[model samples]
Structure formats: structure tokens, C-alpha cells
Target: MMRTFPFGTAALLMLFCSIVSGAWLGLHPAAQKQADLTFWTFTKIHYDPYTETIPTFEQQHHCKVDLQLVDTRAVTSRLQAAMLSDVDVPDLVEIPIDFAPAFFRGPLEHVGFIDLTQRIHQAGLWDKMVQARFAPYTSRGHIFGLPHDVHPVQLAYRSDIFAQEGVDVSKIKTWDDFIRIGRKLTIPNKRYMLELYDFRSAHLEACMFQRGGGYFDPQGHCIFDNDIGVQTMLWFVPLVAGPHKIAGSIGSGQILTQAVEDGYFLCLVCPDWRSKSIEKDIPRMAGKMKLMPLPAVTANSRHTSTWGGTMLGITRHCKNPDLAWQLALHLYLNKKELGKRYEGTNILPALRAAWSEPSFSQPRPYWCNQPIGALYAKLAPDVPFQYTSPFIATAKDKLGEALVACVQYYNANGDNGFEPFVRATLKEKADQVRALAARNPY
Candidate 1:
């Protein structure tokens, strides 16, 4: 071949092979490669809805999607490690509200999430979405994620219990009224008006946020020990402790459902998602439960607070951010999917336009035929902003510790000097948070 092979013959054979390969490829287009996108989420509830739309998305974009359900506790740490190591990073991820601040710890330019400010504004989403929802995902005027829900919190009460006791929930408009009426209804450890925990800060945090106080200000500075905080603690400590206690502790999951079945607590802090969970977990209690606005500190105070939330964000390492953004929109803003989600999860959409979904107006038999979606939607505008910081988790832990100390002090010394002790304890915690912030300085 080296001595006698002709270049023209070799060239002709190569051309024929190329033509055959082209013809084969034309006949079997399915063999062509597609751009692959990897997505990670923490729960099946968050993952299942996409099953309806992913096929359409793949077909339209000519891409493949690989959705992975990761454990909530492990997802954030794994994401951080993958991003830091620059290997096996997902193109899209769902970040829980509690875990969001962890990704925002470093300098703005170095944040793991891609800056989405320009894109959101360009797409007109900045105005189309609920404005308050952006507070948790924004950093230095840059937005990193799109909100997944409004999560407005309301008070879900056992109407049957209230009616049996001849109590009218309508007359109770303030926290003071709630406590006073609760005192008459509560029967020591046998039954309680509501649930709170001296060892946890969730209920306390919700109440504080309702009162326009939270762990951090808009500037990401710690303000957990502010005047409102002290006053909230002073009012809250007696509800779960002391001689005038009107609350009990009912842990979450099946324990919570069982407690409701046994009538352990008459009222629960019902965020929109919690309502759906209750409906699914104990379907028989549908007619017994009803929704009402959270009792306010003042007549003008906001009637609702936000609880749990999640957001969809694109990673900086994503090879195709434009595609990821499109996918996020497909999942989050599609009215049909949003309506379906509302029907299934009772989670209000953050997009204002989606509020008009017929599902929002339909009376849900699960909530005693109350238009629960409309109820949550009515208070959606008033839900408080949840500002975030890298120190927020730490602040929450410290707040829980302060709550415990205050409860113990009240138990030992009574309400005679409870206010001052609460103030001092909150001040110490605030100082501790400030010290940590000073060291980190983000």
C-alpha cells in the first residue's frame, strides 16, 4: 500500500464513507447528542410537579433534564462542596430559606449563585412577582433566585372545639384578646389554646416577624435584641411558661397530626403549606378546621407572617444559564402548573399573575369549603419581609437559647421581674450575634 496506493482512490473512499455517515445520521436523528441539565431539589413535593412539564421542555429545547432528589440537610453542604471543588455541580438547585444565607456568605462577586438582577428585570419579572419575596434572595441589590411561594401564615383553629366552648373567634382580634380568651378555654395540661416551644425559636420568630421585628435589618446587620425583640420575648415567655401559660408543645410530623386528632392544641400557626399537609395527613378533620388571620399586636399590624419558603437558583458554574433560567420560568410561572400546585399543595404562588388561577377561588372542602386560596391570597400582600444574613441561623440559635433562659428565669422567679430579665438576656444574645458578625464582616 505504501508503494502503490493512489491518493485519488484513498480520497474517493474517504468521501464515500463520509457520505454514508451523513446519510445514516440524517436517517437516525435520535442518535444526535443533546445538552444535558442537572437539577437538584430536597423534596418530592418540589420535584413531582416538574414531571408534567419536563417532557415539553426537553422537546422544545432539544435537551435532556436529570432531576435528582437530595436530602434537605445534605443538599446545601453538598452543593457548597461541589461548587468549591469545581466538580459535579448541578446547573439548577432549590435552596430552602434557611440554607440560602450560607451561599451568600462571601463577597458579592464570589457568590456561588449567578447574579440574576439584569435578567429578571429584562424579563419584566421584577414587577410581575411579589416584591417582598425578593428580600431573602437579594444581595447588594443583586437577585440570585426566583421565589417559589408566598407562604403567608394564618391561624388554623379547630372550629368545632371553639363552637363547643361557645367562643367566637371573630371577636378575638389581637394577641391580648387571644391570650385572654385562651385562658378561659385552656385546661391545664389536658388541652391548650395553641402550641409554642420554650426550647425552639420558630413560633417566637414568626410572632416577632409579625410584629415587624426579625433577626436582621435590610443591611444584613444583627438586630435580634432590639426593643421590639425584647417586648416580643416579654409577651411570649408567659404563653408557654409561668402560672398564666395557655400553650403546649406539639412536635411536628405524625406527632403533630396525632395531637390534632386527640385535640391537644386548639389552634395552630397555619402557613399555607401546613394547611395542605393537614388535609393530606388527616383527611377526616377537614370539616373541623377553619382559617383566620393571625391575631395582631395592634389593629394596624400586618395580619399575616411568612413561614417556610424555597427558591430556584442557577449556579454560576452552569454551562448554560439561559437554558436554566428558561427552565426555572417553565416550572415556576406556568399558570397551568401553578394552578395544579395550588390544588395539590395549597401553596400560594409568588407570581402575582398566577393569583387569578380559577383554583385560587374554588372552595376547598379540605378547609371546610372555605375559599382557603382566596383567604391566603388576600393576606399575601401583607406578609412581612424576611431579611437574610449569613449570621441569621446563628442568631436564631442564640435567640432560642435566650428564650430558654427567660423561660427558666420566669419559672424560678415568677413574673415580678420577668421583663427586665428578658431584656437583659436579649441584649446579651444580640451582643453575641454582633460579635460574630464583627469577626466575619460580610
Candidate 2:
């Protein structure tokens, strides 16, 4: 028999002790010489340009930065606990786009994060940043964090496969066009036009985002089950389950990579990270792969949306906010540092100024000489900016549940009952999220 502690008890206890120990070191005023900053991060970047810049930053400021890498799933809970306990808080940390909403639920001052508005204005960085990327980290007219990467969404397709199937990629200007082309390309159990298994809710979210539908409206009300949302689902369900059957279910992780390599799906709606992974994993796809702006809901609609990203933030508990801000500014605003990070990870930089670097416009031999970075740079600004609410985490979980339920129902009963079932379930989930948000815990 094994006993389990609550989610972050052990980690929080250790962090609290570390903070207490550090405080003890400050008992003598004469012993305090320079400030020490702790930085926590989830993704372990072995060759981070930010890490390289730290030596020079420390030399100039006479400070030391301790970079701590932790499990990705534990970050949000740990940060919340540190805020409540007021101990062992990191001076700097990275927060994912989706998680940013949850952290921004309340007043910025109460959230244990320093407001970066004045600092940004002082640095004259307003025009230098990707303006659209600012929305996710802003709440109630307060800016809490700085963007790290731009994850613009696009359609990655197999040009060879589409041509072989007698489908013209350029004719796919809308979802209807995609459906038409997809129907022709799908070969029952043999191949498909798109992947539907692991990314079902994500696909729906992308479509919703593209059509200007989000989990909440600007006033922080749940509107994910609006007319536009229902319309998107009605249009989306058939592609996955009906006679059009354009999508095939693929498992997560290695199975997905294997499916793509074997040509099980001709196209996938993805962001910058996935596109990069494809080039790295299947180098043989050289001239066969091509990227296009995501097919619009209508010919006149917007062409693209965003998917995943992260931002850097400074904690209010930091002993040296000035030094922490300096370090963060260096990491995000330094063109040389951002360019290096982009080269190593293929993560599209959130600094708008970085798009003009010569490297960003270069063609990739792995992508049929496509200027992948340049294309994403063009799409980045077009991504619709939307508000994310504190209840986004809850809404995300409920939306996923609804998606899974609807997918199973559609597979079992076919198209006859899908539209109504999906509509009703999604509406119910949206209502639940609205109720949660109305409580005003913030």
C-alpha cells in the first residue's frame, strides 16, 4: 500500500526551506553583497542562448542566477502554491499560453507578479514586440508577462501526395474547398486528408479561434457555444465521421510520426513546433512537403490562427526586481539571443523585429525550399487576438470531454444524431464553465 501526498506538497516544502535558508544567510547586513535570483522553467533547453547570456549579465550586475528545471505539469501548481505560501518564489519563470489565463484571473498585484506595463514603456519596447501575442497574458487592463515565441498555425501538406491524388492545393481557399479535395484524396482505410485522433478538440479549437470564437468574451463570459461555434462543429463533424470521412484517427507520440511518414494522412493543421519536428524526423520528405496558410472558414475569412506558446514573467517576491527585469529584457529583446534560440529550436520568435533577420527568410531544403519562417512571419500578425479567462483550464477540460464523447457517439451512431448531440453537449459544457467563472474567486 502506498500513500500519496497532495500534488505539490513535497516540492513546495523543499522550496519553502530553500527560501528560509537563503533568508538566514542575510542575517548579517555586512554579509549581503549581491542579489541571487532563482529562475524556474519546464522545458530543459540544453543550448539556450538565454543561459549563455547569463554569464555576461551576472558579470555586469554582480549577481548570480540559479536556473531550476522542473517537470512541466507541475509548474502551474507550484507557482500558485509559492504565491500562497509567500516563500521560495522564483524571480523569473515561463508560463504557457493556456496557463496564463488561469494566472491572470485576479488583480496583478494579488497574483504575486509584478505589472510590466511601466517597465515596457520605459524601455520603448511596445513597437518591438509581436502585438497580438500580448492578449493571452493580459487581464482586466493589466499586462503581466512578455511573449517568448510565436506559434502561428498553418496547414502542412504533402505536395507529392496531393498531386498524385489529382488535387490542386491552390484551389483550397476555404474549408469547403478542403472538404472537396479531401473527399477525393481519402482512400477508405488506406489514407486520409487529415489527422483526427489526438487533435480532435484542438482542431475544433483552431476552427473556433479562426472564426473568432473563444472560450470567453471580453467581459469574461463563456461564449464557446455561440452560433459561430455551433456552426463550426456542424461543419467539422462530417469531415471526421460522415461520408466525407476526410480524417483518420492516429495515436499520440510515435504513432503520429509513423503515420505521417507512411503517408496515412496527406495534411495536418499544425503550428511552428510540429512543422519543425516533421522536417527533423522525416528528412526524406524534402521536396514533397509544403506549407500553406490554414484554409479559412470562408473565402473572405481570416487565413490563420495561433496554437501554442509561452511567455516570461517576473515574480513580485523577487528580491531584486531590477536585475530580474534586466535579465528578462536581455533574453527577449536581444536580437542576437533570439536568433540563436530560433536557430537551435526552430521556435518562431515573438519579437517582431526578429522576422527581418536574414536567417528567417532563408529557404529550407527539408521543406522543398519553402521559406517556412518567412511564411509564418506573415501569418503571425494575422492571428486573431482574443481574450482568455481564468476559467480557461476548466473550459479546456470540459471541451475535451465533450469532444471525446461526441466523437465516440458519431462513430457508433453515424451522422444521423451527431449534430444535435454535439451541440447539446458542448452547450452544457460551456454553461458549466460560465457558472465557474461567475463565482468570482479572483
TM-score of each: 0.91, 0.87
* Candidate 2 lDDT for residue 258: 77
Model 2 misplaced stretches (Cα beyond 4 Å): 1-35, 45-47, 197-200, 408-420
The CA-based lDDT of model 1 is what? Answer: 0.88
Question: What is candidate 2's local distance difference test score?
Answer: 0.78
- Candidate 2 lowest-lDDT run of ten: 1-10
lDDT of each: 0.88, 0.78
What are the root-mean-square deviations of the candidates from the true structure over C-alphas? Answer: 8.6, 7.8
Model 1, 286: alpha-carbon shift in Å? 2.0
Best by TM-score: 1
